[model samples]
Target: MVAPMGIRLSPLGAAVFCLLAVGVIYHLYAGVISNRYAAFRGRTSVDLRDLLAVSVEAAVLGGKEVKAVRDENHLEEKSKGKTREGASEPLTKGDLQSHVKMYNLLKSSFPGVTVNSEEHDNLEDEVTWSRQIPDDILAKVEGGKLVPANRVTVWIDPLDATQEYTENLLKYVTTMVCVAVDGKPMIGVIHQPFTGFTAWGFVGQGSNMQRRSSYSTNPPNVIVSRSHPGQVESYVRSAFGNGTTVILAGGAGYKVLSLLDMPSSTSGDMDKGDAYIHITFIKKWDICAGAALLNAIGGEMTTLRGGRIDYSASPLNTGGLVASIGVDHRALVDRLPEWDPERH
Candidate 1:
């Protein structure tokens, strides 16, 4: 073979080659190479703590939309249908607006994760919200771990108490977000629009709120839905005693707040609720955030049958629910009558 001739590139050619090489390296690092490294190391691409922080912000954004709608007197309401108990299921402009805001924020922040929202309507253009976690909140969740994007499901109830909102029961209104990993709720954020209060928790981590001192009241004061109190009052009385106090409330989020001793904005005092009971069909989005918060604080929330509610399953939770803090959960379950789907 003949001796090879030497080749040289011009300055422009050299510069172009360097730029193209850098672009290729960046693409590999941003996608294929990084993904393979993560898989090999069994590490998740998304941090659970960051996701939780973003979710808290998303809830606050949704709540702002809700409050704006009502405060501006631009509330518009319609009934989707009647509930199983023949109660009107209300949908409002605030609900849809809040849903859009929350959904867009989550989707934009974590494009790979799955987000489930109660309202199906996509009414407005997508909005961009900050993914940056505040320094204080980030410090609190510093030790939090990571989870695979596919394994995490974000459940959102942009407007938890639409019926109450329509009736001007603003104290019961809340925007909630729950991050469930492998069907177990791991993080929760609840924001009260009118009160400008926000509470958040991460399982195995700390929370922004503390368990109430009166959480273990004997013959516990049971909280039930004022809108759909289907035999829950009687069930609570039967399980504990005829003298057991039943506190009727509007929203599932509000009931959980009461149990946590979060002062009611309207009353300016802690709402009296030791346990929350529900015998009718409830949506996962309505209760998932509360369940996660309870779990974070060493509390328990389960089916009246003492079964774990799986968020990966159907959105509807047909089984009865009972949640309490600083109480014997199993004993409470053992005392309650078996929850029959056909019968209450």
Candidate 2:
């Protein structure tokens, strides 16, 4: 039998030892979360949540330290004939396309993550996905990913609300990055890279928002685009006219990012709860990742008429959808005075 040492472990020491053991075990388990699954193969079996997290990490995780310079060399290439059906100006034809730069930047952080785009022929659905991006765009998009139910493609009037970004508008062009899964937003992640603002929602868990400010609150804030106006403004005015106010944000991502924080106006209005949910205007690429993020965070996504959006089958998946959180949803829709909105 082993003899006990004179220095017996006190209760406190014993408790500390137990906690250390638990911590060590947790650390080891966390380190192996992805690896164990690595050997667990199945092309379509990857969890949307994990993949979404990986994508966000890839896009943002190391934004500062790394500087991805735009391929000015592609300027001449862009002048050539290559074009992605609906790419905006300035991004016209290009050889060493900006996609190469974006892909390289993403690869630097995502490591093995791949991006791919191909002509998808979903005969059953009668849709196709295509784009002539630099080959690198194919890196991160895997073959069997869980696409948002309602894939959307949005056309922002201009990049970053050119006029506002020029004047350094704190918030202008703020809009929604809407996503839907089974006609509801399963994930949504709105981002404003310039301000490092990110708002995400995953159905079943909860929706959260973050901003550049060092402040925090628990109120519902409504986002409005100074450059892009929408019925949401009318809703805000109708709902809380005197007390509630709409904040100006630039870009779809910026609008959703603002939702992450309870705005100043709604600071103590519990009656207001959370702001409206339907972001009618949506663009596919604009909301693809955002929708995925929202789905991962536990939220329902769907078209205005509540239809599923298959992101995988098509490229230009632009459509209208709503991302709601704690509001009289059906009642809100009923209020819309549209003769054929029933068909939207």
Candidate 3:
């Protein structure tokens, strides 16, 4: 004979179930509600940059194999086989792995904010201008033009040093993001994953966690990429003369960080001080974050010909750039050759 019994939940069981439900609700609130910073949109972008840096660093440390992917257009459609113009090669999977993480995180954090990340740009109208505007950026009015922070674009580079990261040169790897309004950068965030350091700033807000010393060296030590040397050696030799010292490093973000006097073990070394020069047409994601930081320290990042960067234009920086902490930036720029070797 089979005995039929009614299912019953004991008081202890009910209490446990209730606690579990409460825990789940609390976690959801923490992720969605508590993290909802609709008003401080600029700060939100900076925070997300830090989150991506931490996430990517954790993935690397956890022994997860990072597959490399290269998409010249820097679009989010690597999986869909779509890329922006001038993309000649296939996307690398490892780079896409980090890029996807950053894209999703930003998209989730600032629901309708316009994101113009290197990994994704052609977002639907469903995902634009849904977040609050930062007051500092909103208050900015230049040459009779009111800054439209509400309709700004957020540029992100989830992982900057793809090749260096693959080669285990972790120090050079960084996560970078910047907010631009009407083609002008208003805020920037740069995070070095391996070093666990982040630098962020908004125009007129001074700096976000960056320490700088008022020091300059004669002959000026220049920072150049170890991966892409280009015509840097000859240019420095001719422009600054043979007395100029060149420091070889990987990643554009890292090179700019050094220019900002970012706190590092080697920061105390006065030898590698002064400028960061790139002769090749670089992607905007690689320069925007660093440009914001440099601007915060009373520094300037301009084309070698002393021209301004227009973010609203194409993603490529055609004129090349020279970033310097010194006020004598014009003198520095005058030293460089007129044409970019990669371009001309």
How do all models score by TM-score?
Answer: 0.85, 0.45, 0.65
Top candidate, metric lDDT: 1
lDDT of 1 by residue, 1-344 (tens): 99998888999999999999999889877887777876754444578888888888989999999999999877888888998878899999899999998998888888777899999986655677566786656767774486778788899999998889988988899999999999999898989999888888888877887786755546888889999877777878888899889988889899888878575454364366888899999999999999999999998899989999998778999887999887788887888887774554
Better of 1 and 2 by TM-score: 1
Residue runs of model 2 more than 4 Å from their true location after superposition: 1-50, 61-167, 170-188, 197-222, 230-248, 262-281, 293-301, 315-319, 339-344
Q: So what's the TM-score on candidate 1?
A: 0.85
Overall local distance difference test of candidate 1 = 0.85
lDDT of 3: 0.62
Candidate numbers, best TM-score first, in rank order: 1, 3, 2
The runs of at least 3 residues in candidate 1 whose Cα sits more than 4 Å from the true structure, single-residue gaps closed, are 1-44, 263-270
Specify the poorest-scoring 10-residue window by lDDT in model 3.
62-71
What's the residue-level lDDT of 238 in candidate 3? Answer: 81
lDDT of 3 by residue, 127-186 (tens): 222244333333431222233335656677767766566556667777777766667776
Best by TM-score: 1
Q: Residue 90: error of model 2 in Å? A: 6.8
Clashing residue pairs, candidate 3?
A: 67-94, 68-92, 68-93, 68-94, 69-92, 69-93, 70-92, 75-119, 76-119
Give the Cα error of residue 52 in candidate 2, in Å: 3.3
